[model samples]
Target chain A: MEESKQEIRLPRLGEPAPDFEAPTTHGTIRLDDYKGSWLVLFSHPADFTPVCTTEFMAFAEIYEELQKRGVELLGISVDSITSHIAWVRNVEEKAGVKIPFPIIADLNKEVAGRFGMVHPGQSKTETVRCVFVIDPNQIVRAMIYYPLTTGRNMAEVLRLIDALQTIDQHGVATPANWKPGDMVIVPPPNTQEMAKERLKQRYECVDWYFCKKKL
Target chain B: MGCISPDGTPTESGKKMLLALQKGLRSPQDIAKETGLPLFRVRSGLRDIAVAGLAEQKDDSYELSPKGTELVASLL
Candidate 1:
């Protein structure tokens, strides 16, 4: 007798994001609605928690910067819509900063389960901090996971988005500590002749395999 | 390379340890227990924090240095 197996699909780099429609603070949002813009889909454990509160505030502060780069932010938690609304109101009133993004209320863990945010070893009922940087085409470009105790680096998140957009525009990779206006790595040459030619290229080359050029 | 190690960014465990340190969780064992991370990973994170000049060892416990405090403050 053959046993039936369930296929598990996790969103990965260079692959399409798992689409979903969910209720949010702003309204019910669908993944396809953000088709032409980059999306940062992030998950937190719960609202009203200290670490999660700080993260939400940080994300709110960077809302404009992300928008300027044509990127949108979507926050998700396994909390009800009522709780999300109240928390957003409380945060805005206390912090005096406007949260211009919609936060998804994944009360049933539907979105969380689909995104693999619920790590049993971490906490069965809470979602760990997970960030998925999806490109304009809905491809998962980069992913970062943080435990519940940690708050994410907003600067690093912005930098990653910039790097992803840069790579999309130019077929190149970023080097360590790469920021905007920094030298970017050139794609490695496939052929020996190309490698030899790469060394003679105008870009600064530490070696044939490692060449960097300014954007 | 950036000031952060292991790909110029703190690993997840390192981040967790740093947050715990910011909250006055000084002992590595305490951080491990609080953050639900393995003791070895917590120790590794503490070492990374020290190397980054974010924390200082005092006897068997650790505390955030001035620079580390400043860094955490800037995050908020």
Candidate 2:
């Protein structure tokens, strides 16, 4: 008998995001279409569930703010386009929050399979909450996952974007709980010569290996 | 069909998308509908044209930039 199992390919940071063409609430979309913008490709278990609903509202609330930061949001689930549309309309009618982003309706699970959104250990039928932060060049910058029972925190998502953009803009790493205006961690020197010279610079330093600087 | 080349030249579909925008089509869906192109093609074309400095994004819509308008006029 032939083997029945297939290996799941999860996305990794610094790798190109898996390209996909799928039907969305806005219309048919492809990963290539977002070539010039940062994308937050997030997946929910379903459309009408309580936790997903709340997450949708929160995503809606940050839609404009994300746009201002040159980020676009694309949601996904295994639900049909009909279900996605109806749920969006319902959210607008009852929750009064307009979902401004496009949502991919992965009825065939093609996208979920590519991104490994469905964890068989958790549930076979539904996808877990997953987020892939893709940069403008279509590289997967970060990935976050949550169980079915939990909703995502929008602030953390925003902060992650800020951190990545800051790293790209200023060539520095962000510390834990790092927000904008906080001192950024400088890269440690590889050479002893540079290490000695690094201490002479006007940056906050605990040691040669650890230094923080203001951009 | 592909929309734009890596060097920023507009392919056939990209040109059609730009013409659609010149005819007052703004959103990607609208451009796709008007040009009879796939939504993905329209969107990818829009991004490519924007990168080539031929288009500008305004909120949820896109429009031909001054450079884009000049290019279209020269093509005509």
Candidate 3:
């Protein structure tokens, strides 16, 4: 039955995100340092690559806005800091967006392997584009894996972060194709009486079982 | 100092240890436990024992050589 649905091989989700302590141009950073804050742990292909350059620029432009929402970004690639520095410099000069986040020097690929980013069948020397959004409590809220050729949607990433946070904080869920400012799913009624009462109320909600409330 | 060069060296204990690790052992503590050596020494040995396609670290542990485990056995 499960196979009938697409055979999805996903990374470890709903658990503690993998911890990494690696040297960067900004010196060492332990994954635990971002424990109390939301984290966007992302992986990229080889350095100085064109597609990855655009993704980096997009993330950099929105880095501050993400932080305003109490989130941090950490980038990883299987390249040395020398390569990473050169790539960032090129992106900054050509793309005109300076990266504010630190890029991990995963030359040994320890952290990449831990996160299962190294999809050898796709590309042996490169990592498939992967992003993990982890909440403050160390649980993975969402994950996205992209093909090497197709660039990721940066705005969608921000929207997902917003959606997840909203549902979590409001004790609700989002409807299909949910976006910011859209109505959210109301919590299922606990008792039959409450269910009947919920149906009678007009809350922009469609039905008692599946109800929605404006963000 | 008894040291193995990062890039080049014919064969050292560290290299041998990496071979031993690739053959079967996973954790440095497990390798140390099997080798009857100090845990710290095992970690120090691995820092310089960078053999391509030899070993991979996983889940806060290490993985053995994916293939050619039999060829590695001749050394032990």
lDDT of each: 0.82, 0.87, 0.73
Please give, for residues B1-76, the per-residue lDDT of candidate 2 as tens digits: 2465567556777778888889753998799778876454577568668878888988768999998888777666
Clashing pairs in 1: none
Every model: iRMSD: 17.9, 6.5, 10.7
lDDT per residue as tens, model 1, A56-76: 999988988997898889999
- Compose the digit string of candidate 2's lDDT tens values, residues A57-174: 9999998888788898999999998899999999999989899888899988899999999997777778899999999999999999999988999999999999999999999999
Better of 2 and 3 by lDDT: 2
Off by over 4 Å in 2: A1-6, B1-76
Predicted structure with the largest lDDT when compared to the true one: 2
Give lDDT: candidate 1, residue B10: 57
DockQ of each: 0.01, 0.15, 0.02
Chain B TM-score for each model?
0.79, 0.84, 0.54
> Which candidate do you rate higher for lDDT, 1 or 2?
2
